[model samples]
Target: MENRQENNLVIKVHESDNVAIVIQAGGLPAGSQLGEGTTLAVPIPQGHKVALTAIAEGEPIVRYGEVIGTALAGIARGDHVNETNVRLPEAPALENMPLATRPAPSAEPLDGYTFEGFRNSDGSVGTKNVLGITTSVQCVAGTTDYVVRRIKNELLPNYPNVDDVVALNHTYGCGVAINAPAAIVPIRTLQNIALNPNFGGEVMVIGLGCEKLQPSTLVSDQPVKIYENSQAADPDANILSLQDESFMGFEEMVDGIMAMAKGHLEKLDRRRRETCPASELIVGMQCGGSDAFSGVTANPAVGFATDLIVRAGGSVMFSEVTEVRDAVHLLTPRAADEQVGQALLQQMQWYDRYLEQGQADRSANPSPGNKRGGLSNVVEKALGSIIKSGNSPIADVIGPGERIRKRGLTFAATPASDFICGTLQLAAGMNLQVFTTGRGTPYGLSMVPVIKVSTNTALSQRWHDIIDLDAGRIATGDASIADVGWELFHMILDIASGRKQAAADRLGLHNDLVLFNPAPVT
Candidate 1:
């Protein structure tokens, strides 16, 4: 098959569906056969729908093998199907329904799953080799910044393989209820950063002694160099005192680290591509700057690839719990067990309560940009947002910053905010992320490489540097969803091995962070 195209056509998303949708416009005849079980006539503009078979009024219209809407009027084969004929269904009532359940698979070992990665002393595999300077509180942020500036301008050039010099800065640590048991949250967050597989070498942690978050107490068996500014009578004087001397010492330390890193990189580069078992793959699905096409093209295509990953024995994670509010019913049935499904429901309930207490409507989503792109309500946006997970069984539900212990498909329940969800997913040990966007986004995490997929051709052309793949072709009838999905799968493997740079990396836009907040202090 031809690799990519520049036209639009109607496509039948599922065999059970009686209608097809328009993906693109131009250069097609009234009666043209495109692929197996699909045909078109005239041009169907992007976001418009077409009929696959005759449909009677009130019958459900299926996309991605689930009901996206119901027919409002009788529709014929070869005719456009859209808002005129289809209306969104009422939110599925999940409170009374028994949670969805799925049978556990008989243990089938995944075959040949491995990546060229750094093996830490602790046995965890790292995707990148870097030296990090972290701070325990906002007060120490400046010190960490000074340390990083000195390293980046003077020491880092000597070590070309070191990915970056980053200072983890945040707004928390000193203010608010510091004595609350919840204060452990910041400490745990810091530990997660140090333990992240992205950091292959030593880390220098700096902290203000007066802060409730004591840097000395957060020690780990891992290799880290801790420094407390409070010990010095003059903190600024201490910083100046360590400048030149510490710079020279750090340069030598970096040289040795780079030598070891060079050997690791060479070995990693020598590792040739092999057919790794799909089960070894763990994917995180996220959406931001969404538009109407988000649910129609990129989201479902991601879903297709997600299914392929699962069948290959790899795992996938879907977050942004609030965005999928109305669509959770569709996912519950696929849960690994009733309890898993119930856990998801309970989390959603808690999210609703939190929002209610804040005097915010749970349905007030689809940010301004989303509405400008033809999305009307949170319900409409969410109906399309959940497509990225595919139809894999929901094997588990993970809390914020929690590690995903099981290997099957999982749901990391996080707020709809992109940065917050991204941080949690990376903390949960997701090495790679597939972020879909219709409006375009330039955000990425410090450690994990984000592969940005554009839902429309216009956005892809406008922001080619940030978009790694274009799902617009599916909308334009230029590529089949399955074909695009497989193409993305290979692209992911290449990215994992550092063979390709994601759009965010190319733009140097990788310093976004978000703290997952589950409740509010009233």
Candidate 2:
């Protein structure tokens, strides 16, 4: 619930929540009277929390009806509740938690929605028709990039049906323990990204002849879960080796790549958009630069949209393992079954071990930008971040860099870094993504269309050119989550259908693909 007293708007998420966030831009002054006989004990920044009731030291500081932290000292009513005065709380125990105990979702099925998309021979749908050139080793990224630019400027004009040419460049495939057990993560990531639906199944690979990770291994029939009928065969035909004996110079290498790309472009240019059901859409949900309003507005609105997409029989993925670690207890019961529930726990436990191995913990998250935006710690941030998942049953779970197989909601485990999370989602077959931010970011992906949703109207209006939607209306009481959600859902279809372009795409913004290489350097 929310209240406006003396022109001061305060948002309290739950009745049991003893704190409420100040909503006024630039914040309110000390002595300002808030509702419920509460007066500002001190000035509070916008999106920062204010204690609604006085509590003794060592008491739990609650938000979203969960303990986010413990007060380090006695806190007075209307005082600020922030990291300085709050100590981090222990994470929830993973043992003996409820599993698949929530009742099945009963929302009426959303029907009659369709979008124009490119249908691949593999029976997968593509939101964009692009020729993707994959590089097996980082040694070939420069040459591949040069070829991509040449193809885009020289050959792309003739292929009017093709959308864009992307160089799948990353810093992997060399100087690493290629045979390490964890090496499969980056290797398969490179492979599955080649099979992304938007590439139109015209897979192309470029590599240096003597690199540790061979180009053939990328397209080989391994366990990367290649889409059915995908073009993952005849590696010699698909790969262009820059260091081959026939390539005498850099120019020849460039020409060789462009020649291969032109062939893929010709096939991609022959593809046309056809009507596909909403179920064909695979959307990845992520958040960055989050403030308290991330949960109050943007994420919840995205969550509502997530539920809508699930109802329409489409697939949705919510990732960022550390961001979800502290809130895993809230999700276990929502799993589709005991097996799915256990999968969720396994991913959480795996991430926990991964963090421990690095001598890090969940405290490493809720970055400085996040802290400045009023996220006290990872615990508070986790509660807010999970709101992007909505209330859908956990249909399946996949580890880092694995492809999503089932429809509906799936938790794709990934680190909290914005670039890494986005890259893995691409490998997992996401054709479109919706990212929420509050402190603001210019983050975009070259492989997919990313819809940026701002958690506050200030950010939306400030970064008007880049932000696709304003979920801030929910915080200001100008709209409901359902209203913004429906708008977002419609926008997703429009962008997926190529009927409308996201602001990021229109502005030609893109981030480099950063692979998650957990293996050791050899």
Candidate 3:
């Protein structure tokens, strides 16, 4: 993992890696020496790979000691290695992957790490005390949105303790195959989001009575009992139907929702933050706008923080099905047991089928932005993306939209899309999110505070207000992964305890929640 930066800075991850990524701010010009004997045959962009030795035609292009692709043509030393000259190889076969061969590292337990969080009766903790209004169908979204604005502007000020009001609006619940097997993904996602600990167990539903999926069906009848001290009212009692004959006009409908929201707000306002152990933390890990530096810097730094979280008895989840697909073999061996290993394979196979159903395949990834950032294809991108999980034994696996009950690192299967992954993580019970980015994005969630880490100092300098931490120091030799990891851990406690606010939260930058609905829409 050492990089020589005195001359032309280039990162060589492993001794066997035939290529090292260029780290110069403006890239190195042709004939520039890279400290190594090799000279640049051509100008290389920052983050792009530079060949260290001549690669014969059809030879494997290696990074992280794995074949990311094959050379399409002969290459000279220091020649740029990119999608143009690289041909993607077949994804590793899902069968016969090593299962649970690596043992979990033994480390002294991390103690006395605590944060101020709202305690819920369900024994789960909440970082934010919010009122979440769930909608049974998109038909009620506009009305719910209007009422939520009213709740925030009008009633929210009255109840000083409630953090915020969010309309759990989505494009599901109606005009789809409600009974389809795949429908459970989005349906359970919405149901579990309402149960997100941040909502403080006060659930309200707004619906149009004529929809195929009824409001009562959206929330379970025994939802209150799931929590130990839950004082939630009946799901039916809190549901407000816009088309219920009692409402004469739109104003009446808005008033009904407003009144319903007030009761929830009052209960939520009464709740106060209390000191909770770090073990209560459920952190979700994700990466977007990734470049080659992601695996080298930010993601690895996050991986270190992830291990710290798990060492403290806290839970951490790393998701993105396609991102992990190519690197699944590396993960399967780290599973806690054979069953967990199989579960990892199951998710990969399911997603493989999903892509095929859409007439697509794994190569669909490495978005244009990704390629511009030095990722030649999905394999290269995946090798960089999975670094955030750290080296913990994956204790469990959960499919899309399923709630995670096991602690430690769990692989929550989800789409590679930023919004979908965040939404599913919310349903999986994440109270905070640490997102790493190299290419840069404004992605954020209204439900949880997002702590953004920039993969490079350049992006950090340009987007100082948005990025919470700069891991690029690792590339420049200013900091080690442990330095940034410990820093991020302390920062998480501060942000989760309400002592600090994330930049995204401060700017009110939130992306809309997008549900993963694989079922056919009619």
Best candidate (score: TM-score)? 3
User: lDDT scores for all predictions?
Assistant: 0.66, 0.88, 0.89
**lDDT score for residue 430 of model 3:** 98
Model 1, 26-144: lDDT tens digits are 33456666454456644555444566777788887765566766778987766666555676676566587556654544444435545555555554555556665565567756656
Q: Candidate 3 overall Cα lDDT vs. reference?
A: 0.89
In candidate 2, the residue pairs with backbone N, CA or C atoms under 3 Å apart (3 or more residues apart, or in different chains) clash, namely none
Error of 3 at 38 (Å): 1.5
**Model 3, span 209-293: residue lDDT tens:** 8987777666683342111112443323467777777667898778767766777787888899999999999999999999999
lDDT of candidate 2 over 7-27, digit per residue (tens): 437888877788888888788
> Candidate 2, overall lDDT?
0.88
Weakest 10 consecutive residues of candidate 2 by summed lDDT: 226-235
Arrange candidates by TM-score, highest first: which order? Answer: 3, 2, 1
By TM-score, the better pick of 1 and 2 is 2
lDDT of 1: 0.66
- Pairwise TM-score winner, candidates 2 and 3: 3
**What would the TM-score be for candidate 1 when compared with the true structure?**
0.75
Report, for all candidates in order, the number of backbone clashes. Answer: 12, 0, 0
